[model samples]
Target: MEYMVNLEQFYGPMDLLLYLIEKNEMNIYDISIALITDQYMDYIRATEHIDLDQLGEFLVMASYLLNLKSKMLLPDPVEPSEADQESPDPREELVNKLVDYKRFKLAAELLGERLSDDYPRIFYRHGSTVLPEPESELSATPRSLHRVYVRLLQDMLAQDKYQIPQGDINVGEKMSEIEHKLKLAGRPVHFLELCHRDLGRREILALFLALLELIRLGKVTALQEKRFGEIRMVIKC
Candidate 1:
């Protein structure tokens, strides 16, 4: 009977090593390096046409296995101390690497299965031959929104140059102030209205950060009605 081996299944030397270990029903921690090396060499010789780049990696692994096998066969040198007699196994490092590789391979297989299951539910919108006009809300890009803020900051800075001689402005205090102002107004307030003439650059920045924090917390929301329009802050109901 002729035996056919599928060489394409093995990804790398570690993968091939894992397969050989499992096939022989051998413990991964106490692998028989001599037997594995001989089987690996058989596989390499059996293959007619192999990629040079891939073959190099397998050859390096084979050389390592041969060297390790030789080390295992050699008798230990005479040592005076008991601590020197309790030396670590030569296969410990290789066993650790193989264990890690096996864990990652298992995780990858799980992810691939999940992706395959969800593939059917994934929908893709087909493109139309005729292009349609974009919606008004979609027309306002982040760049335009940034420009509006920049313009507002420039106007505020041009009006006042006096720096406040105070300690670090508290973002929590600004957030409380914003909450109070929004409650009093009972409507969406303009972003610029949040800053006062007496406030310094740092104070403004702190207030802006506070607003962002509030929005992130889902307590407040910022909205732009039109393209390059005023951004309004509203307390969420």
Candidate 2:
């Protein structure tokens, strides 16, 4: 089974940072490092499951924010020079990067809009086709050509009638299935059994929520004997 995970659903750390900054109505040039870092950590902690590859960048950015905050807490070193010597802000580099990235993002959006508006109008002309001579009694008509095109389209669509698209996995339904499985086994069941490898991301998420709901309801006990071990589910008496 092929898995179709939409990575676009997740936003990068920079996007989150910008959101926080704008949400707080704070100036990008002089952001409150401590406040932003705390808010960032809250968002990170709120996420229950994350792909490590995507999470790594967020963690790195979080560390950078913390470091900036630490610097802000400390007093600046005294400068002996009186000749217009100035210390740069810790967030200067980060702010510059955010500004540049925002510019690029806006430019890409504009380009996409322009392409969408203009691309369909730019069509290639096909070479002339040899037509079959019609009998004197029969004449070719545009209506006939349109009817044939519509029939062809309808036939193409009908060919896939047997293949049904998968519907959204429901958490409540999955929870009931898990409960039935545990009752049938009369013993502990491995987590992987409940969450099949072939299941798509949406199904996996649904299964996870189902398990959590069961746990919350005190209907099942989830256990792992060792660190990084497979979770075992046992029906609660």
Candidate 3:
């Protein structure tokens, strides 16, 4: 039997930096690339069968590190310019980025912890084993399974009252724009047709997630014209 390797699990340099910084528990206020670079190289060596096309960016960053390391090694014959003296340290900039990204991640984690404490697993009313109701009252109309899914979503949003972060702005706006365009056209839009418009992986991912959110909110419905035909989305009635 032969073993197969999956290189897809390794995220790039930033992922590596996040791991190191977290492992060390050192303040992002102080970062040493000299230390980071050595560990980065060790990680690279350990990774086998990395696709060249995918690995290109990491390789470029590694080459950059080597160049910077070489520059740091060269003995200075003359003092660096006054500008260089005033300028920020490259290591410091990297540290600052790690710090900022970490803050958002920390923010989400904190919110998650708050959620656990704030909401009861189940609320008790004047009954035996009652589930909590939505913050908003739902309609008593009949619904399909899909419609029920959306109603459940509307209920969750009402109960939880999600406050969309500024970072979440782009995706929401794009999704709304998509909804508007579909509405104007007055027809169901093919999912692929909607997905193709210049959304990079992140934005595209955001749109998909937003659609799911909308589906949960009873704001959209999906339809399939044929067995293998494209799926279409229309505003839920």
Highest TM-score scorer: 1
Q: Which ranges in model 1 have alpha carbons more than 4 Å from their true place? A: 1-6, 78-84, 118-237
- Runs in model 3 deviating more than 4 A are 1-11, 51-54, 75-87, 108-237
lDDT per residue for candidate 2 within 60-94, as digits (tens), equals 99899999899989987756674367778778999
Name the candidate, 2 or 3, with the larger TM-score value: 2
Each model's lDDT: 0.86, 0.84, 0.70
Over 57-82, each residue of candidate 3 has an lDDT whose tens digit, in order, gives 66776777776666556665456665
What lDDT does model 3 reach? 0.70
* RMSD (Å) of each candidate, 1 decimal: 15.8, 20.5, 20.1
Q: Looking at model 2, which ten-residue stretch has the lowest summed lDDT?
A: 1-10
Model 2 bad stretches (over 4 Å): 1-10, 80-84, 115-121, 126-237
Tell how far residue 200 is off in model 3, in angstroms: 31
Arranged by TM-score with the best first, the candidates are: 1, 2, 3
TM-score of 2: 0.46
